[model samples]
Target: MKHVTKADGGRQPFDPEKVQRTLRKMGVGAEDAERIAGEIAESVPDGVRTAAVLRMIRARAKAVHPAVSHRTNLRRALGLLRSKPDFEEFVRVLLREHGYQVETGCVLAGRCGEHEVDAVAEKDGTTVFVEVKHHVSHHRVTGLDEGRIARAIIEDLQEGFRSGRCVVAIDGALIVCNTKLSEHAKRYATCRGIGHIGWDYPEERNLRTMIEETQSYPITIVAGVSRSVSTRLAAAGVVTAKQIAYGDATTIAHDADIPLKEVLLIAGRARAILEA
Candidate 1:
C-alpha cells in the first residue's frame, strides 16, 4: 500500500480537485462539491491523516445545505403566525371600542394555576374576562374540548373576582374563539351564566358594526384619516389607534382602497409610536 503525503509531511492527498470529483460521484452536485472541497482544503490541519480529511469532507457536504432545510421550517413558522390567536388582537380592540375599560395580557387563576387571559373588559356595571383562541382549520372544534378550556378560564376568573384580588368587577365572563367553536361553546357557557361571542371570519361590515356599537363612537375616530378616509371610516367605523391596530388589514385594504402592505406599515409605525 502506498501512503500519500503532502509536502509538509501531512499524511493526506492535497488535491482538492480530486476530492471534489469524489464528492460529485457520491451524489453531491458540482457546485456543492466545489464549496465542500474548498472548506475542507482550507481548514484541515496539514498534519491530519488522509482518512480524517475524507471523513471531514463527507460530514461538511451533509451539513452544507442547511439553508434548503430552513425553507420548510420557515413555511411552517409562517403558517403558525397566520393562525396565531393574538395576531389580530381582536378581543383587545373590541372591548376598547365598546366602552369597556380593558386590561390585556393579564394572567388569571386557572384549574392548573395561572392561565393568561387575552383581555379583561369592564363596562358600565358589568365586567367580563375574555379568552380568545384562533383556529385556522376547516373542521370545527367540538364543545367538549373547547368547553373545558372555557370552563377552566371562567372558573379562574370567578375565583379572582370573588376574592377582590383584582380591580375590575366581574358581572359576566366570556370565551371567544373561531366561529366554528362559537355555537357549541355558547350553549355551554350560557348554561353556566358565561357569555360567548362568535366571529366566524373577517367581515368589514360586521367588524365595523361591532366597533361602532362597542365604542359608542363613530369609525372616523377609531381609524386614522387616510387617502380612503371617508369610505374606510364609513365601512369600518375604525376611528382610533386601538381599533386600527386590532382591525383586519385584509378587510381594510379591500374596502379602503389602500394596499394591505400600506395599512400594515402605517399600523406598525403607529404601534411603535404608541409603545414609545
Candidate 2:
C-alpha cells in the first residue's frame, strides 16, 4: 500500500475512506466524496503532503460548488480569525454552543495577581477558565508550553478560590485553539486534567466536531468575507456563520457598516454551508 504524508509530518497508508469521510464532513455528498477520493488516491504521487491533497480535493470541489471548495479549506477559514480578539470571540461562541454560559474579557483573581482571561465558561455548577490560543500560521502548533502555562494560571486561580479571593470557585481550565496540539501537549493535558479542544486534538471531541454538531462556524468561513471584512464582522460581534444565516441581511449590513449586497452574498454562502 502507498502512503501519503500527513500534516503533522507523520505518514500513513493512503486511505481513500479517510479522504471521503473528510469530504462528507465538509458536506460533500457520498457519491461525490467517494469519486473525488478515488481520483486523488489513484493519481496523487506517493508521499504527497496532505496539504497538496487538500488542494487537489478543493480543485475538484469547484465542480461541486465554490462554497464546498472553500469549506474544504476549513483551516484557512479558521485562520481568518487569526487575530487574538477575533479568535477569542470565536471561542466564546463555540463554548456557548456546547451549553456553557460564557463571559468574555473577564478579570479573574489569582494567587499571584489578578489576571485577565479571554473567557470564563460556567455550566452545571462547574466553572472553567477558557483561554484562546490563536496561531496566525498553520505551521505553528500549540505545544507543551501552552498546556504548562495554562496549568500554572489555573493553579493560581485555584489557590485564589481556596483563599476566598475569587468570587467563583475555580474548577479547571480549558484551552481552545485553531492549531494542532503536539503529542506532548496532549499527554500533559491528560495528566494535568486540563481540558483542551483544538482542530484535531482529543480525538473524540475537537473544534471541528463541536462546529459540525452545531454548525457553529465562524463568519470567516463564509465564502466571500475577506480577512478585513471578517475582522469587521468580528468587531461588530458578528462571529458565526450560524448568526448570518439566521439574521436579516439588511440589519447585519447596517450594523457592520458593510454593504447590503456584500452581506447578501455572504449570507447566501453561509446558508449554503449550513444547509448542505
Candidate 3:
C-alpha cells in the first residue's frame, strides 16, 4: 500500500518537512517549497485543507519555471484573443509609449445612435477620437468606391457636433480607413473641418506617418467658422486683419457659435474679390 501525506490526501501524517522534500523531488528548491508551504498555512484555517495545500504546492512549482511563468503572466495581461480587442490593446500600448492617456472602446454619436470608436487619446488636456478600419484584401479595396464611406464620415462628424463635442473640443477626429480617401472626399472633409487619415498599406506604416504628422502640426481648429468671419468681426472693433487671423474663434464667437456654412460663404466672397 502506498502512503499518502495528509496534506495531499494521503494516509500518512501531515508533515511540512516531508512536503518540502516532495517539492524538491518535483524540481522545486527547498527554500521556495518552504516559503510556499508557509503561505498556504497562513491562508488556511487551523484545520489543514489537503486540496488547497496541494494546489499551493503546484502553483509554486509552476512559478519557479521562468518561461512558463512569463508566458502565463503575458496571457493574463493580454486578456482574451478577440481580434478588435487585440488591435485596440496594441494601439493603446503605442499611444501610452508616446505619453498619451489612451482610452479604448469610446462611444461616439453616429447618424443612427451609438458608434464604437476604437480609441480616444488625450494629452495636455486635448482629446482625439480615432476610428480604425482593417481590410484583408488589396483587390477588394482597389476596386471599391469611397463615396459612401466619405459621406458616412461626414455624417458622423455632424452627429458628433450635435452630441455637444465639437471638433474644436477634440484635437482631431481621424478616420483610419484601409483605403486612402479620394481627393474629393479629402476636400469635403477639409471644408467641414474634419481630418482624414488613410492606411492603404500595412497599418504600421500608416500609423507611423499619422503620428509624425500629428506631432508636427499638433493644433487643428474645427470651429464652425473660418478666419474671415473673425477678421470681419474684429475689423468692426478696430482689430487688424493679422490680429483677427491670429485670435481664437471662441474668443471671437462671444455669444453665439459661428455657423461653418456662413464662414464658407464669406470665404467665397473674399476669393471673388481676390480674383478681381
Per-model TM values vs. the true structure: 0.42, 0.91, 0.33
Q: Any runs in candidate 3 off by more than 4 Å, and if so which?
A: 1-83, 109-112, 138-172, 200-276
Which ten residues in a row are the worst by lDDT in model 3?
Answer: 215-224
Worst 10 residues of 2 by lDDT: 65-74
Clashes of 3: 1
Residue-pair clashes per candidate: 13, 0, 1
lDDT of each: 0.53, 0.83, 0.46
Over all chains combined, what TM-score does candidate 3 have? 0.33
Q: Is candidate 1 or candidate 3 better by TM-score?
A: 1
Better of 2 and 3 by TM-score: 2
Instruction: Compose the digit string of candidate 1's lDDT tens values, residues 1-276.
Output: 223454345554478888897665344678999988888778866566665776676566557532121111111111232233332354465666657688876776543466666677777767777766555432345354655776666666567767765444456666654434445565666577766554432244233345334432222232233434534433454444444556787887676677788768655543432332
Winning candidate number (lDDT):
2
Task: Write model 2 residue lDDT over 1-276, tens digit each, in one string.
Answer: 779897679998988998898777777789999999999999999899888887787778678755684453567778767567888888888889889999877898987889788888999998888888887776678888878888898889889988888886768888988888988999999999999999987788998888878888888776667877887777778899988878988888888888998888888878888887
Ranking by lDDT: 2, 1, 3
Worst 10 residues of 1 by lDDT: 69-78
What's the ranking of the predictions by TM-score, best on top? 2, 1, 3
Give the root-mean-square deviation of each candidate in angstroms: 19.9, 2.0, 24.2
Local accuracy of candidate 3 as per-residue lDDT tens digits, 212-259? 333211111112223344334433331221222334444444522456
